[model samples]
Target: MSALLPLPRLPLTALAVAALLGAAAGVWPGAGIASAQGTAPTTQPSRLPTAPAQSRGTAEQASVDGVVEAVRQTVLAAQVPGAVVALQVKAGDRVKAGQLLLRLDARAAEQTAAAGAAQVRAARAAQDAATREFERQKQLFDKAYISQAALDRAEAQYKTAQAEAAAQLASAGAARTQSDFYLVRAPYDGVIAEVGVVLGDMAMPGKPLVTVYDPTALRVSAAVPQTLAAKLPADAKVQAELAGAAARITPVRTQLLPTVDPATHSQTLRLDLPPGTTAVPGQFARAWLPVAGSGDARVLVPAQAVVRRAELTAVYVAGADGKPLLRQVRLGRTEGAQVEVLSGLTAGEQVVLDPQAAARIR
Candidate 1:
C-alpha cells in the first residue's frame, strides 16, 4: 500500500494551517489581506487633557418671578347721567390732556342755557331801570315833590327788583356752566385700555366709562415671601421683560402690605417703576433682588455640573484618588454660566463637568 501511494500528499488542513501561520507572522495571504494585516500601525500623538476648574470671584445674582403693572391707572366715569350720544375715542387710542373723549346729549341743556341767558339779559335791563327809578324817587323826595311814604314804597320796590335780578343772573350762570359738562375730556395723556360706553348707551354717574393708563409709568408688583423679604433692598435694581421689551428699572420704593395672603403666605410688595416704560398691566415678569455675600468665600461651579434626580439635586466631586464621589449640594444664585455652591463641596475640590459620566463611574 505504501508503494501505491507514490508520493506522500500534503493534507489540505496542513496547507491552510501554514497559510494562517504565515499571515500571522506578517506574510501576505492576498493583496487585500496583506494590506489589511501587514500595514504598519498609525502613530497618533496623544493630546494632553485639560481639566475644567471652578470659576473664581463670580458674583452671584438673585432672581424672582413677578408681573408687570402700570403705576398710573385711571377709571373714567361719567360725571352726569345721560345717553352716550357720541364716542370720539376707542380702546387703544392715544389721547392728550383735555382732549374730548365723548359727548352726551346736551340739547336740553343748551336750550335751558339759552333761555337762562335771555332771562339774565332781561333781568339786567330791569335792574338798571330799578336803579334809575330809585335814584329819581330819592331826588323827588329830597325836593318834597314826592311824599316820604311814596318814596319809601318806590325804594322798596327797586330793592326787591334788584335782589330778584341778582338771583336770576346767578341762576343763568349756573345753567351755562352745567351745559358744558356734556363733553367728556381726558384728564391726562394716556392710552385707553378699556371702553364700556357705546353710542346710544345710557351712562350713569360713578359708572366706569373707560379705563385709561399711562404707559410711561409702569412697574412690577410681586408678592415676596416673608423669609426673603428682609433681604430686599430699598434701592434694589430690577429688570423687567414684557411683550418682548426689556427695561432696566430701579426700585423707587418697596412697601410691604400690612396683611399676608392666607393662601400664598406672602406679603404684597409694590415696586415703583422708572419713567418712559411701556409695560402693560397684568403681564408676568421676573425680578432679581441682591443679597450681600457672606464674608467667608465659597466656590462656584458650571451649571452643567449639577444634576437633578427625583426630589434631590446632587453633584459629583472628585476624591483624592481621582474617582468621582456623589455629594448633595445646596445651590444658591446663578451668575451667568456659573452657579454658587452653598454647601457639600469645598473650595479646592474638583467637580466633574459631565455628570452622567461621573455617575456611571460612581
Candidate 2:
C-alpha cells in the first residue's frame, strides 16, 4: 500500500507526467501504483527478453533538452540618449557591417559641435595676434626700444594664447566625435532578429534597440548534471533533434563548460551545429551526448513497459517463477518508442511489455 501512495504529499493522476516529459512523449499509458492489497497475481508477459544497449542504440544515458541559439548574437544598444528619428531596418532584414540601422535626433549634438568649432576658430585668431605682438616686443627689447619687463609680459600673453588654442582644438575634436553617435550602425553582417524601438521612441544610454544573429553558425545549448558531466567525451558523437524536424542534427563540435552552476549543480553543454543546418535561435531541441565507457550503461524498454501513475513512474518486472512484481523506477530521457531506465532495474532482467497486461498478472 505504501507503493500505492503518491510519491509526495499530493496525489495527482498519471496524466500529469506526460506533457512534462517533453521528448519522452511517445510511450504507452500505465501510471498507477499497484500494491499487495490489490490482490493480483500475475504471470510473465507475452514477450519476454532483455533489450541490450547495442540493440536499442549506443546512445546517451538520458536526453538533455536545450534551445537552438546563434553562435554570434548581439543586441545593439544606445550609446547616446536621444529620440529615434529614423528606422532604416526592421526585423528579418539582412544588414551589412557598418550599415546604418537607425538614427537619433542630433540637433543638440550638432549645436554643441558647431559652438566648439567656433571657439577653436576664435582662439586661433587670438593666438595669431598674440604671436605677432610677442615678436614685435622681442624686437623692441633687442634694440633697447622696450624694457625687458614689457617684453616678458608680451611673451607670457603669447604662451597663454597658445595653450588656449590647443585646449579649444581638443574640445572641438571631442565634440565632433560625440556628434557621430546619433547614427547607429550594425557591428557585423547578420539578419536582424528583433527591433525594440520605433520612430519617435525615446532612447537612453544602454537601452537595447536591436537584436541580430548570424544564421550560418548556430548551436544548441543544454545543461547536464555535474555527475554526468565528467563522463562526456570531447569527440563524442552528439546528436540533436529539433522540434518538428525529421532529421537529427549532427554537431561539428561538442563543448563542455568547465564551471558548474552552483544553484543547479549542473554544467552547460554546447553542441555546435553543422554548417547549413537549418535552425533558428530560440527553437527547442533535444541533444543526446554519448557518455564515456559502458560501466554505467543504461537500458531502454518500450514505453508500454513503464506504468505512470499518481505522479509516480514504475514498471513491472517478471520474477524467476514467471510471476510479475511492480517495481518503482526513475525515468530518464525519452527517445522515439523507448525510454531510458536510470535505476530500479538491472541488465538482462525481463520487463513486462504491457503494463495493463502486467497489472492483470499481478
TM-score of each predicted structure versus truth: 0.65, 0.62
Q: Worst 10-residue stretch by lDDT in candidate 2?
A: 50-59
lDDT of 1 by residue, 1-362 (tens): 35665787876786698778878988755655678688876643222121344546543445567888777789988777889998999999999999999999989989999999898889888888988998999999999999999898888988888888888889988988888778888888999999998899988889898888888877787777776666666665544434455454666655557788889888776776667655678887766666555124656888888889998888877766677777899888666788878877767677777777676552
lDDT scores in order: 0.76, 0.83
Tens digit of lDDT per residue, candidate 2, span 11-55?
655566654563386643443333444666554355544333213
Error of 1 at 267 (Å): 3.6
For model 1, where is the 10-residue window of minimal lDDT?
43-52
**Model 2, runs deviating above 4 Å:** 1-54, 57-62, 141-144, 234-253, 274-277, 292-362
TM-score of 1: 0.65
Residue pair clashes in candidate 1: 66-285
Candidate 1 overall Cα lDDT vs. reference? 0.76
Candidate with the greatest lDDT versus the true structure? 2
